[model samples]
Target: MTTPDAPRHSRPISFAIFLAIAGAVGWWAAFNLTVSKIEVLENPSVDLACDFSVLVQCGTNLTAWQGAVFGFPNPLLGMGGFVAPIAVGVGLLAGARFARWFWIAFNVGIVGAFAFVIWLISQSLYSLGTLCPWCMVVWVATIPLFWVVTTRNLVEGVLGSSLVGFGAALRSWVVPITIVSYAVVVLLAQLQLNALARL
Candidate 1:
């Protein structure tokens, strides 16, 4: 499951870099999805560019009951929320270290994001019977962002000074863990949707 080591000459891929990349990608996807949602809102019958296939389309999800869970397009939250990680990552790269309270707050937001994405995943897999590609991008970005930040906090002694072995393992096992997690999702999607056959 381990892929490869990061470039040696380059600075090691820190949690901050992961945060920045994930945030940027997630924000971009959310922005696109939001625009697609608007397009659908203007004309529900119109086809979206992201509507690639019946099972891999965003249009179905955009109109789903869970899509507007808070009475507005969910991407609005992503658009706003993703900026924080990018900012924090930039700050870190610029040599800014955050206080414990800030880390705590940031982690709380990440946990919320993780929970919300899980709900969307279940909804997409079980209820909607379709996929939102951009949303999937967000989900892919969000999961590792959550784990990387959390494990970094643990490894860096940001959260606590205990469980050194556990922290080390989490940090070392990132690639494999992500591979396994992604495999599980892919397997579940294939199982529930028979995703490839429908294509």
Candidate 2:
């Protein structure tokens, strides 16, 4: 049985740093999307600042039904959702640790975000036939953020059973796994969307 006096596995400072980095990127993406949305509302035909080319276009995605899945722009969700991580990161940096339930809730949010981004990536590749730069930025940050946070959760035993030795093993491989996943997505985009050629 775990003893109450036993030292808990506290999150490292680097975790907070990475979280802050991800939050900043997410915030930037959300802010720009909000701007693009406003522009669209102001002038239905207004050319978005992020509308770079036919391939890398936010206008197309913004106009898509998938853009406003909840009857509001998706970025609005980001604007609010990303605040939690930022706050949490700041708290961690200040030496505050959360309860098991809090970590579980945070992980759940990241999992949901990861799933949504995956769907967005698929739509951008197959259905939309377009990629938004801002959305892509969110995807980039979300991937690593989810990776690190999920791995941390497993290692810290926040989810049900404590992983024990498995957590350390997973942590060691997390970066490589995240990198491979990112490469696969980029490669797929290059093959299907000609992302490299567009660049």
Candidate 3:
């Protein structure tokens, strides 16, 4: 019989699949914006952000060397790398149970993508001196998606609940703490960046 204290199992694979889909959409938008900029640059046209000046200018940000950090269009990387995991995620969500190793591997990929998003934001703020609005959209979308995917993995025991401890330590403290901590950190970082901009 299932005990009252039995852990509630969620579909981590399904959450991962959803994140992958959202990431793919973000990547597509970014790619289209990049391509549009290229066309405009090659033959000059009404500026993309004519109404907005400075940091909000898409044309200014897109034309920067840092925008093509790979020495080619950066969106290509997003298109190729970001979409594959979503496809894998969809397979898993379809009830194709993955091995523990596969789940862990995908989790690592999500962490890597999270790190890369932070790096890109830093580049835009400090190095590029301009922001790609679509890229910011990707950043915002990625944060919650990562949190949900990671939380689902933890709750479902795919990452070993013991790694975060067990019992009340797992359910009550760790999960809530993680969620709140992430939200706080993201908020602080955004505020700090905005503060710096004013100085």
Candidate 4:
């Protein structure tokens, strides 16, 4: 996985740009959520801009126990966690080559983020019964980010040499795969929450 001999141009410029853009979007969503949380704290009954309706609002999710799974606002995690991808993307754009260990660790973080997003989706659709607008933006950013990074890592042999061929095969289908992933979420929301009518 170590690519000490790999040429500088081995880095994918498009992937770097995508990573930076996704990270920026996710960070923006997190920042908004953090501000909303602060406003709620300062005035418990304050209404947030993200609150659209009973079925489409951030108030419920923000106040729920799930929002603070780690005893703090969940958006705080995003505020800090998203910086990694931004830095990595900018580094790659600046001709910085990451070591194998770095890629492995970064991939692990992305996997964790994807998993957390899955959990939040479940909570939003089944338990919370509402769609947080800003949170959905975060989800949109994360879903594709996870897919692209994981696929790129596999294609680059960051995960393992044995999976390189499979990764290469999957790389070209990443966009479609991501679209299907989003479709599944939308379908679930429609089926369970009748989200389409509510919106």
Largest lDDT belongs to which candidate? 4
- lDDT values of the candidates? 0.86, 0.88, 0.64, 0.92
Query: Is 3 or 4 the stronger prediction by TM-score?
Result: 4
**Can you rank all candidates by TM-score, best first?**
4, 2, 1, 3
Model 2 has an lDDT value of 0.88
- Name model 4 segments beyond 4 Å from true: 1-10
TM-score of each: 0.90, 0.91, 0.68, 0.95
Measured by TM-score, the strongest candidate is 4
For candidate 4, give the lDDT of residue 35: 93
Residue by residue across 1-199, what tens digits does model 3's lDDT show?
8799997655566455676677677677667766756766686766664216565556655666766777876666666766755676676676566777886787787787788877877777666655566776666656655666566567667888675444324445544665675566446546545633532
Deviation in Å, model 4, residue 122 alpha carbon: 0.1
Better lDDT candidate (2, 4): 4
Residues 79-114 of candidate 2 have per-residue lDDT tens digits of: 988887898899899889788999999999999999
Worst 10 residues of 1 by lDDT: 6-15
How many steric overlaps does candidate 1 have?
A: 0
- Segments in model 3 whose C-alpha atoms lie over 4 Å from true places: 1-17, 44-46, 49-51, 164-199
| lDDT value, residue 151 of candidate 3 | 63
Could you give candidate 4's per-residue lDDT for residues 114-144 as a string of tens digits?
A: 9999999999999999999989999999999
Please give, for residues 1-199, the per-residue lDDT of candidate 1 as tens digits. 4448754233334756877988999999999999999999899889899998889999988888798899998999999999989999887777677788898789889989999999999899999988789999999988888888888778767778895557788888887888887888888899999987887
